[model samples]
Target: MPAINQQSEPVIEIRELVTYYGERKILDGINLTVESGEIMVVMGGSGSGKSTLLRHLLSLNRPAAGNIRLFGQEVNKLSSRALHQMRQRIGVSFQGGALFNSLNVEENVAFPLREHTRLDDNTIRIMARMKLEVVNLAGFEKLMPSQLSGGMIKRAALARAIVMDPKLLFFDEPSAGLDPVVSADLDELILRLRDAMGVTIVVVTHELESAFRIADRITVLDKGKILITGTTQEVKESDNPRVQNLLNRRTEDIPVNADEYLQRLTDDLAGL
Candidate 1:
């Protein structure tokens, strides 16, 4: 399905993207678009290529075939200088906070400024505090990662991600390790960031509640292909078995041979 509003250039446009890890295809002929200022969620079960697709969006992983355009610029064709400029316009937060253990919260937030701008130490510190404040961690600048709760660490990481005032933000599994209440709060914070910053957000997750709550549109991936792309309402109304399985949270009931099941269990146990 097409997006709700299509008057302007899409913040992100990907077509026929095929990515592979060696010979195994991770993303196959995937197509997607994220409109400016909209919250787009990419969702899937484990090994469904959601993260691979996000890597393309982040310019970390290029497609083996097809193209990715970010804000009208072809990502694959970007020169190093262009790519660097493009990266400055985007912010990314990983599933883990990815904060620097060596630096305090304020210094972690100030890292981008120090690397990318000519700002003095005092100015950078002040700006870092302001960004921390935006994420509700104003007075916690002096705190270390070990001193903060999981949610606080996540928020502090967010403050750092947005310190450069990016136009696009990518989040990988924002609610992965969080409790239900914390996950919901993270969802609300996502919405607030969208409204407050007017930035395009691309979130990769399998968390159904968080996906539905924060998404303006969603793309569901299955077996290296997009099962569907539509609004939350459209997805709910879909009659496709794959989509139904996801929405209804039903596991496959296909009967496995006893030996196969035992071997699978053994494999899992052996891996552990």
Candidate 2:
């Protein structure tokens, strides 16, 4: 089979990346790239280092080894000023929405602008409202985070994340804590954003249904290593046992030994 080259130039690249937390290795020899406008889902079991990889991509955490480049610029080599400039071109919707309790939707959305730019309050408000409209929360700008449903909170956070009109968007488990219908809606929103804004999206998620629905390509991580990287179809057809079990939801058919089970139960009962 011919190799699938998804893009002409990758927007985010990680080559042989390794990460450590004190004495423990968090990510091991990670190599992956996300192309411009591509929805690349990083799928993994809990503690599989998917979030660690995302942090590395955003330069929130430095790699212990190898290289990470964003928009063709080495992340570690960038000066602090340049790094901030690079971050301005990217939007991040963190898990749990991460909105402030004190700030209403509009104020929360405008927070980035207030901190990063010289835009006047009026302009920030307009921009914030525009972004809210994009996420289908146009008239709810005055509502508190507590008043919104889980889905609405996520959408509002998304609006805030994109207020800067970023070229790259990172979503950390966009569908976490959401019901199936709401999760699917968020997937559709991700699709629309990519199509409309030409933004490269990196989603860190383990939800099989959501990942398969939204991802153009997916990378599976296990034991601090990448198990596979392929399109949804390709991954579904993967011959690796672990991949097959994951995609097919096939459980290991372990047969219980009758003698051992009887001995354990009977011994416990006798002692009782």
lDDT against the true structure, per candidate, is 0.90, 0.89
User: RMSD for each model, in Å, please?
Assistant: 4.2, 5.5
**lDDT (0-100) at residue 45 of candidate 1?**
97
The reply for model 1, stretches above 4 Å from the true place, is 1-5, 253-272
Per-residue lDDT tens digits of candidate 1, residues 74-151? 999999999999999999988889999989999999999999999999999999999888888988888888898888
Weakest 10 consecutive residues, lDDT, candidate 2?
Answer: 1-10
Q: What TM-score fits each model?
A: 0.90, 0.88
Q: How many backbone clashes does candidate 1 have?
A: 0
lDDT of 2: 0.89
* Maximum-TM-score candidate: 1
The 10-residue segment with the lowest total lDDT in model 1: 1-10
